[model samples]
Target: MEMTSRTKKFTYYRRKATNVIMLSSSFFSAIITIIPLFLVFYYTVREGLRYLNIDFFTKLPTPIGEPGGGMVNAIVGTLILIGIGGGIGIPVGMLSGIYLSEFGKNKFGTLVRFLADVLSGIPSIVVGVVAYTLVVLPMKHFSALAGGVALAILMIPTITRTTEEMINLVPHSYREAALALGIPKWKTILFIVLKTAWKGIATGVLLGLARAAGETAPLLFTALGNRFWSTNIFRPIASLTVFIYEYSKAPFKDWNEQAWTAALVLIMLISIVSLVFRLITRSKY
Candidate 1:
């Protein structure tokens, strides 16, 4: 009896120590992750503040050494491309997610799930190449439309996965309750299940947008940056990512400063969007 008591005490003490170690490791990892974000914001704001001006938000890009040239064109182009991508991707992704969660126990659903997994793993540059060949080459020009399409491809898998998981998390009781009211399966899903999961779905869409916004490789051969202001979806457009890429490669100090400023803008935009989404999800709204 004494031996058995000692064995139990030893196991309990070991488990307690292990849990303490695990908790400390997790705390340190979280601190490490947060430190980089703070450092990045500090550095970006410190370096980029000199270039930030009213003109920087209003005027268009100009010659490399031009003093007053701004990121207005790139900002507009980024918005347009992301808007188009979201418009195309969200509906398709939501539908696919619904199908996967609601009716995807069969062979075809399994195939789709497998394909989504595979597509998610494919590199962004590969998608850009495919977009170039299929959309840009055939059209004989890089345009905002092509970039939007490439970004849409990247957004779809993320949306689908998140939507599927969120929808699945909706309580079975909710669906049953709706059905007991003589509601059809489609109506139940549309009215009850989706309503309950709306916040999660919005979070997924925001995440997808954040991912799409930072992409540079796919936009390289697709949008192919413009120096002047343009609103035409059919023409090449300047985006912050593309502008950052092109400027960072130039041999001019002014252009490099603009690149850093553009990068800061992109980071800030994504962070705001993410925080807004988190707030929306967390609130009763």
Candidate 2:
């Protein structure tokens, strides 16, 4: 009886130890992931605080050694790129996702899925090259429109995958219920399935936008960069990432400071967008 009791005690201790180890590992993993974010935020704010001002948002980028310049042009260009990219990306992504989830049981669906996976893995620089060839080269000039196309390509795969996953999570019972109520399959999917998965879809779209906003390589050859403010989509436009890249390459102190400031701004913008997406996904709507 003592031996049996000892065996039971040993088994209990083993299980307890396993649970403790698993919990500790998970906690450590989370901390590891968060450490880089904390460091980035700390350093960015430390370096950028001095340059944070209303003038920073209103003035144009100056010559390499000049002071008092800002990223107003870059900010505007980033906004325009995001707007155009999102406008093209969202509809195409959503429809492709719907097709993948609703009608993708065949060979065609498999091919599309494979293509999306391949596209996602392709380097951003490659997308830029393709865009340059198809858009910028064809037009004989770098433009915000070409940059938008490059970003749209990056956005599409992310949006498509997330949307498909979200729609798949909707219960089959919802579809059956709609069908029993005399709703057609297409109508049911349009109203019921999409409504149920709206939050997840929005989350994906926001994440895609965040990803696109920080892309530098894709915009490097596509949008290039403008020295002055440009409203023309057909001409090279300044972007925060491109601004940071260009300024950081120079040896000038003022330009370097501006680069750090631009980096900080981009980080903040992405963080805000991600936080908003999280909040939206958590809400009932």
User: lDDT values of the candidates?
Assistant: 0.91, 0.91
The C-alpha RMSD in Å for every predicted model, in order, reads 4.0, 3.7
In candidate 2, which residue pairs get closer than 3 Å at backbone N, Cα or C atoms, i.e. clash? none
Which window of ten consecutive residues has the lowest lDDT sum in model 2?
Answer: 276-285
lDDT of 2 by residue, 208-282 (tens): 999999999999999998889997989999999998898889888878888889998998888987897787678
Model 2: runs farther than 4 Å from truth?
1-34
State candidate 1's TM-score: 0.87
Whole-structure CA lDDT of model 2? 0.91
Instruction: Give the least accurate 10-residue stretch of model 1, judged by summed lDDT.
Output: 60-69
